[model samples]
Target: MQQPGTVDEVWPSHAPENYQCPFCDMASGEFAFPDNLCEPGDLVYSDELVLAFIASHGFDPEPGHVLVTPREHFELLYELPDDVAARLMIVTRDMAVAIKRAWHPDGVTTRQHNEPAGSQHVWHYHQHVLPRWNNDGLYFTPKRPIVDPAVRARKAAELRAVLEGGPTRH
Candidate 1:
C-alpha cells in the first residue's frame, strides 16, 4: 500500500554534507551501539529483509522495548519500498506479541518518526514497539537513557526465547 502522500514526491532534504548514517553502519556490522547497548546477541529476530532487537532505551513503566528496522538503510517512511515496509510491519507485530508474552505489559504501542520535525533522530527508518500501561507516566517523561548493556542483553534473550518458542517467563 502507498503511504499517505504522493509516493514520488520529494522531501525537502535535511541531511548534512558527508552525513554518516549510524543505522547503516550498525546494520552493516561496521559500528556497534556505544557500550554494547546493541550487540549481535541482542537480536531477537531477523531475516533477509529486516532486523528486530531490544532497543537500548526503555520506557519507565515497561523496559521491554524493541525496534524493527530494514536491513538496508532507508532514511524515512516515504523512502522505504512497499515490500520492505510490509516486512518491517510484520516483524514489528511479531515483536509486540513477544513483548506481551515476555513482559506481560498492560498494553503495547508502535511508533515511527519521519524527518527532524517529526522527531526522527536517526536517519534510517525504524519502528519502535514498546510495552505500555495505563498512567505509566511515559507521556510526560523525557526519552529514557540507554540502559546498561547487561540489562539490554538479558531483555533481548527473554524476548528472543519467546519469539523462538523456547522457554519464556509467561
Candidate 2:
C-alpha cells in the first residue's frame, strides 16, 4: 500500500489530453461510472448541486463506504468553485452521519485527494466518507476489490432509506 503522504508511483503527473473523465460521464448520465457498483439512479442523496452514492471500491475495514461529489465535474480542488465546494462539504457531512447511523461503525472518516502526488486515483473531485473501527489498518492494507453490484445496489438502497427517513445528527 502506498503511504498516506506519498504518491502512487504509477499515477500520472499530468492529466493526459485524451483522458476521458469518468466523473463527467457519470454526471452526464453517459454511462454507469466504470467499475462502480452503483448506478446513477442508485444515488443515496442528490440535489441540483451534488450526488452521493455507495462506492464500488470497498476498504477492507469497511464495505459500505460512500463517495460524495459535485454534480458538475471539477477535476481538482483548485478547479472547484467555492460554492460547489461548500455544498459538497455539507453533503459529505450529512452522508457521514447517515453512514454512521445506517452501518453503526465505531467511527467515521472523510478524505479527499488532490492530484497524483496526493494519491488521487480519480481525476474528479470527490470526498470519501468511510466507516471505521479500531485497528482496521486502512492505510496499511490494500483496498478490497469492488463488491458485487447487487450487494452495492442493496447497500445504496439501505443508505438511501436512512437518508430519506430524516435528518442525521452527529
Candidate 3:
C-alpha cells in the first residue's frame, strides 16, 4: 500500500525506541509512554479482542488520532484470529470514517504493526489512525515540536497519569 504522508522530513520513528523494553540504568518508568501513547476517549469500547483509547496528545497530525489495540498480548497482526481481525477491521474503518467526518482531514492513515526491521517496538498488536492535513507537518510539527526537557518530563508524568487511567490533563 502507498505510504501515508510521512513526517520524514521532521518526525522520524526512533529505531529501537522500545518503550516496551528498556536497557539498564534507565529504569522501566523511563519508558512510560515513551512515544505517542496519549489519547482521550471521544469514544471507546472493550471487547474480547481489543481495547481502544482515543488519542489525547495530538496536534499537527491533529487530535483525532485513534488507537485500536488488542487486549491480549498478540505480538503481531498475523497473530490475530479471524474473528479478532474482523472486529479490528470494523473498528479501524469506523475510526477512519470518524476522523474524516469529525476532523475533515486531508487524508487518513491507518498504520498497523511494524517489526524491528519496520520499526515496531511494542510487541503487542495495535493500529494507529493518524489524521493528516496539508502542512500539518512531516517530521516534527511546528505546533507539536519535541517537548522541552521540563515539558517532556511533565508530559511523561501527565501520560503516566493517563496511561495508568488516573487523573485527566491538558
Whose lDDT is greatest here? 1
Residue-pair clashes per prediction, in order, are 0, 0, 12
lDDT of 3 by residue, 80-165 (tens): 65567778889888878877898788887777756677656655567888888776664333465666799789877786665565
Question: TM-scores across all candidates?
Answer: 0.70, 0.67, 0.53
lDDT of 1 by residue, 31-81 (tens): 644533466656787788888877877767556688899998777887776
**lDDT, model 2:** 0.74
Order the candidates by TM-score, highest first: 1, 2, 3
CA lDDT, candidate 2, residue 169: 24
**How much lDDT does each candidate structure score?**
0.76, 0.74, 0.59
Better of 1 and 3 by TM-score: 1
Per residue, candidate 2 scores C-alpha lDDT tens digits across 90-118 of: 99999988988888888888989988778
Candidate 1 or 2, higher TM-score?
A: 1
